[model samples]
Target: MGPSTSAPRPRSCGAPSAGVMIPHKTKRGEAALARLKTYEGVPPPYDKTKRLVIPDALKVLRLQPGHKYCLLGELSKEVGWNYHDTIRELEEKRKEKAKVAYERRKQLAKLRLKAEATAEEKLGSQLDILTPIKY
Candidate 1:
């Protein structure tokens, strides 16, 4: 058989050998190509004329004193122990509620899986017997 004629393969990484002199893109050219590939849509410019009303905002929003601290990061009073205490208590209550919900979901999943496994075990034998084997 004659010598196999195949195209030279490019190096996986690093500088190419003398046998295959492939033209490599410069650092600047590579960077330009990368920038061209990553296209980002231009967002509308911000309107400086817009104004936010802060005074009595909580009352307007219909949010609780605790929610104001948690959601908006705005304290009930400028400086007082009551505001700090309410924020801390609210955060702790939320954490406890989240943990309880997670535990409930996990327990329900385990019960469901056990029920499914038992059902499959009972039906598996009956299904195998009902279906006739073909030789």
Candidate 2:
């Protein structure tokens, strides 16, 4: 055989890159992760202001502070919680947000009805076939 033509395999045990490494879990963190993993969706409980309880969530989830943003992003992707759904779910227990959402929904319904009525009026005004043509 002449010189080897195949490229060398990349090293798995390479030195760390410039970015910070993931923190190793402590005993408590391991236990917390186990507990948090039991849930199916939206890992944390929301606070009264309809925001996620980040610190508490991370602590319970056994995630480092640096990983919070990424965790939430992945969770949203996996759970498919859009803005309105998230807001509604987070504030589900709050009457104020529910009332606000109800008012917005009513306004949207009125707008849709008005649009439909306008479209019907325009269609009605159009001359039907066989009508006498104006000179």
Candidate 3:
């Protein structure tokens, strides 16, 4: 028999890879894609909120020993995505957030000290008024 000429079929077929490469054609699809776009850092509203972690979705847990697997990020980098720059930007954002939080805590402590001092003065003045004047 002659060799078959049909194209080899893909091992797996799903939307995950297509979703990354294809542009959304419909308005609804475009809007959904926009919503799904990655943000540089946590959004303002979610900055202080706890993030959800799925243990099953973790790479360390999902990958078996000695198994070959390419991470999504790695694949994106292979396809010309600047992975390192994105990581650096994220690290910078985290540092900036930490600095802002430290400054806020320092300012709050100063305000609290001032409040305590004013309270003490008020208490001392009240005690003076209650005390008998011997002069």
lDDT of each: 0.47, 0.47, 0.62
Per residue, candidate 2 scores C-alpha lDDT tens digits across 38-116 of 2322334532234445675466567655764444434444543345355445546466655787799899999999997
Best by TM-score: 3
The regions of model 1 sitting more than 4 angstroms off are 1-82, 126-135
Descending-lDDT candidate ranking: 3, 2, 1
Best by the lDDT measure:
3
Task: Name the lDDT of candidate 2.
Answer: 0.47
**By TM-score, is 1 or 3 better?**
3
Per-candidate alpha-carbon RMSD to the true structure: 26.7, 20.3, 11.9
Report the lDDT tens digits of candidate 3 across residue range 45-67. 77655467999989889889899
Residue 16 accuracy (lDDT) in model 2: 21
Model 2 pairs whose backbones collide: none
Considering TM-score, where higher is better, how would the candidates rank from best to worst? 3, 1, 2
Q: For candidate 1, what is the total of clashing residue pairs?
A: 0
TM-score of candidate 3 versus the correct structure, residues matched by position: 0.37
